[model samples]
Structures are given as C-alpha cells and as structure tokens.
Target: MTFTPHILESALLLLATFLIGCAIGFVLRRFLAKPSKLVSTKAEAPVGAKPQKKVAAASPTKAAPAKKGARPAARKQTPPQSDSAESQAIDAGTEEDDLKKISGIGPKLENELKASGILTYAQIAGWSARTIDEMDAKLNARGRIKRDDWVRQAKALNKAKASA
Candidate 1:
C-alpha cells in the first residue's frame, strides 16, 4: 500500500491546495479590488441633460414728472403708520410719489404700501382709522383706506389742509 510514496503525497496535497488558493486570491485581489473609475451608481449626468436657465430681472427706467410746488410738508408729527417700507426704510416722511396724493391711492395700493411699511403721504397722514383698520385687515386693503372710514377721512383732509 505504498504506491510511489502515495502518489507523491497526493501530489503534494494538490500542490498545497493550489498554492493556498493562489494565496487567497492574491490577498483578496490586493485588499478587495475596486476603484478603476467605478463609483458610478448611475449619476454622471450628460446624456441629453438640459436643466438650468434662471436669470431675468432688469425693468425700471421711466422718470420725470413731479414738480408743482414740489408739495410734501404738512406732517405735524404723529408718524409711525405700523412700520412698513420693507419694515425699516421707515423714513415715512412721504414719497413713493406720496402715494399719488391719496384720492384712494393706486398703483396696486402703491405696491401695497411699499409692501406694508406705508411708504408715505406722511405715512398716509399718520394713519389711525384704527391704523387703517389694521392695515385693512392685513392687506386685503381693497376697501381703499376704509379702515372704518379713516378717522373721518383724515379729519376731512386735515380740515381741507388747514383752509388751504
């Protein structure tokens, strides 16, 4: 039962299990292989890609028509009409074309009183019809300063601007 040194010790234990499975597949392909530019779980983004346009803002230019006694002066104090002109450009001394001398102000309620800081006619003649019905119940304005009939229409336009 010695057949040529037991087939040379079973061919040296099958060449030491194929050289220990090629030295454990060359040390797991030199530490778990991977990285020949392969991080692609699919998001490289150029196959017909078309998503990025946003740029459009440039319109304001038209000015030149306000003079007649260059008006604006009648504000004898009482100012703070609920803080609006972007809530802090609070000069409120009056401008934004003095909200077109209020026969019921326009241009979208003068951009909703310059977006709520009531830009001027001396802060809508220092408001107070319960602060123009709490800014016409928070900007649904439309009642055109009917903030409960704006303090008797701002005391009849300040008694017709103090008898003109």
Candidate 2:
C-alpha cells in the first residue's frame, strides 16, 4: 500500500514529455507555419516608390462686362412709407419745440401730426374732448397708435411750452 520510486519516476517522465511537446508546439507556431490567408496577399509598398501627385483644378473664365449702351438697373431704395393713418398723422406734426420736444415723439410722428393739422402747443391745449376722441379714433384705426398716456404727455409738453 506504500508509494514506490518507480511510480515517482513514471510521473517525472510524463511531465518531461508534456513540457517537450509544448516547446515543439510553440516553435511550430512561431516559425514553421505559413502566414494566414488574410495577411499573405497584402504586400507592403516599397519605401522608394514615388507618391502620385494630385492634379490642380482649372480656374473658371470670367464673363465679359455688359455693354455701355445697356441701361443700369434702377435701385428702388425708397424709405418705407407708413400706410397707417395715425402714424402718418403723428409724423405730420410740426417741428415746433413743444411737439418735437415730447419724449416719445419722433420725426415720423411729427410729420403725421402736422399732416393731420395738429401743429402747435395751442392746438394741443385747445383739443376738445371731441377732438381728442376723434384723434384717438383715427389713431386706433391706424393700429400704430402709441400708449394711451401720449395725450397727457402731449398736454404736459404743451403746458411746459406755454410757460416757457
């Protein structure tokens, strides 16, 4: 039932044979085998081979200038005309110090107000409830009427103008 030297010798011999087989397999894989089909067909380009030059594109020819007899196209650069009656009215007001001096009044509004016949501070101060209502209606119809407080501002501006 005890272990014997012969069994140990047999085990050592099997181990040595297995190691030799592995070494032989490693040597075959490294040197003796053919290259894979995926690799064997593709060859590296020669280092001294000349690279192909890319062709430059030809430049496009310019068109000849138009003849002198031809009429030049007229540029239509008219300033935008407001169709809004209130804006037109506001724009027509005078260049007076009081009318133009109002904070929100601009050149266009001044012109419109002038066109509407609201020319002076006295005219603004003289505006009756009916006149204001009418102006308001015209302004509202135009859709470009300013803030509702414009009348008050205009009135104040007119008062300031009169006192000065």
| Alpha-carbon lDDT, every model | 0.60, 0.60
**Model 1's TM-score against the true structure:** 0.24
Taking the tens digit of each residue's C-alpha lDDT, what string does model 2 give over 1-164? 75788899999999999999999999999898998767566653422224588997866676567898999889999975433322223344355544666555678767766666567655555554545555666444342224444556667877776688
**What lDDT score is found at residue 47 in candidate 1?**
19
lDDT score, candidate 1, position 87: 28
Candidate 1, residue 156: the lDDT equals: 63
Candidate closest to the true structure, highest lDDT = 2
Model 2 is weakest, by summed lDDT over 10 consecutive residues, at: 82-91
TM-score against native, each model? 0.24, 0.33
